[model samples]
Target: MAKTKAAAENESQLADPSVDRKALLSEALRRRIVSMEMAPGAVVDELALSEEFGLSRPPVRELMRQMAAEGYIELEANRAARVSSMNHQSLRNFFLAAPLIYIATTQLAAIHATHAEIDELKAIQQRFREAIEQNDVENRVLYNDQFHLQIGKMAHNPYLMPSLRRILIDHARLGKIFYRHPTTHDMEADLGKAAGQHDQIIDAIARHDAQAAGDIVRAHMDLSRRRMTEYVAPVGVEVPLAF
Candidate 1:
């Protein structure tokens, strides 16, 4: 009887019109961090968040802790929370580990995804395509993140999902940079390939083709890495051979 009542209360809360304060704040902070509005290593102001959400410090701090655990923020014993840093080492690790993680997660998703999950993935792809059409950089990055996150969830592996989540935070941040600087690359062709690959990924998952799914994810990551590298180091001046 007690368990039933608790479940009912949970359902009622879900049905409520107002969003939970902590959820609201966490999402807002997540957007800021992922969009680079907060930038890597930016300090999170607990008091400011409390004021914005109309919540007290204790709850705000709890929200910070949650974000910290999710790799979106870093918390220390005596300091304010900071947005997770993307230093040289972190970026190196991201590039090294992202392909394996994405491939594994996608392969598992192909094996375990349900019809409902595939439907949801298709919906996210539609929004992702629309974001590209509209040139909405933030939403493009956001929807892309959601697309992979859904696949990660479908993987149903607790061990892999957490690492996938952490990897995606940096992935989204890097995507924001890539999208924001369209002049740096052939935006249309690149985005078109991405959109098409998204469809292929969905198709592979629907057909339960784990090997195909893994191949697509690896190719997708390679494209992303190439674009990001091009954006980071564009060809220009000649380097001195001697020295």
Candidate 2:
């Protein structure tokens, strides 16, 4: 079978001698997997990656292992690695767990975030706003992931950090639906609202108001859910039919 256009582009990037091949490969894999270019549960071909990047099997396997630990991919004994699947059970669990984790982390961030960490989050938020303005969907997803991951770090809870990181992987993946391909006016509005909420989160954290931060995070989660629903079941006219 022939390679897809994305695969061709990835190969081209890997051919650049001035770049760090491993870093390039990892970043490309994350973006592709999160954006559905690789698709959930897609097989990760270790041999192909090794050959394309001019890496040995051990390094390729090591990279895959790192991705697996980060919730980007999964590995099993005697089987090929696969992009983490977002099936019904997984999504249902995400819905059940995400708000709790997000709220917990944000509340903790309110209590523990240092001034410098808040500055870093503001910087990420600035980039996020720029992505939204330019309709740069890929950067929006990546920056949004970074935004939440920074909050997780500020939370300073070893127990919650892992769960927060894991849920954020799916968050970014699901978010691509609305961010990348907005189908309605509401989605565009929600993007603005999300940006506004980030500002609110920063303010609340800066003030050390845990309750307010938690409340803002809840509203943020609701906005995300609504946008995703609008994407899946968009409001419109009747379906076309031919007799």
Candidate 3:
């Protein structure tokens, strides 16, 4: 009996004494959710995760609670946790709220970002660029999430950070559509532009130019909306659905 690639990787991680098993488990769950491997409303069994990650029930439950708080999953009494569902209403609210939150937080980040935070953002952006160049959809999505999340931290806004975290969960899930399976020229072009925009955002924040940061984020959101729209309703479709 041969171990699967994922199983092998998990074993290797477990072998590493320096590794943070809890963080690794958290990141793995996030990647699965963002990549749609654990699709919307899919049940996440506690015991299965506990076994798979070689973690005890307590740590697994703690991770589940944290993920639930971050909008990745929903928990109910006596029922298994499930990934958050995205339907018409939730999608509508997402669209309505995403841009405002992104722009506001980005502007605030520009005002409050420290030099160390800016440096950290640059490191994240480098990984984002590498992910794009490699065409690794999952890594691309994950790093993109990290990039925005770092900015949210820089915002230093208690009120906005939670909303931003919640918003990004859907953003990455929806992004699976945008970043995966669609190899159209437009998508490729948009990908390049998106990476460029990240750099621009970094620049804006580093300069403490709130206006510039807000404007660049507006364009970035527009790119995301347009990319998602194109995927949902391609050029050949008679009726294109707008996101």
lDDT of each: 0.88, 0.88, 0.88
Q: lDDT tens string, model 3, 143-204?
A: 89899999999999999989999999999888777678547787788889989999999999
- Per residue, candidate 2 scores C-alpha lDDT tens digits across 140-230 of 9989999999999999999998888889889988988657776558778888889999999999999999999999999999888776666
Per-prediction TM-score, please?
0.87, 0.86, 0.86
Model 2 CA deviation exceeding 4 Å by range = 1-21, 234-243
- Tally clashes: model 1: 0
For this target, which candidate reaches the highest TM-score against the unseen true structure?
1
Rate residue 235 of model 2 by lDDT: 77
Q: Tens digits of per-residue lDDT for model 1 on 176-226? A: 987785653477789899999999999999999999999999999999989
- State the displacement of the C-alpha of residue 11, model 2, in Å, after optimal TM-score superposition: 7.7
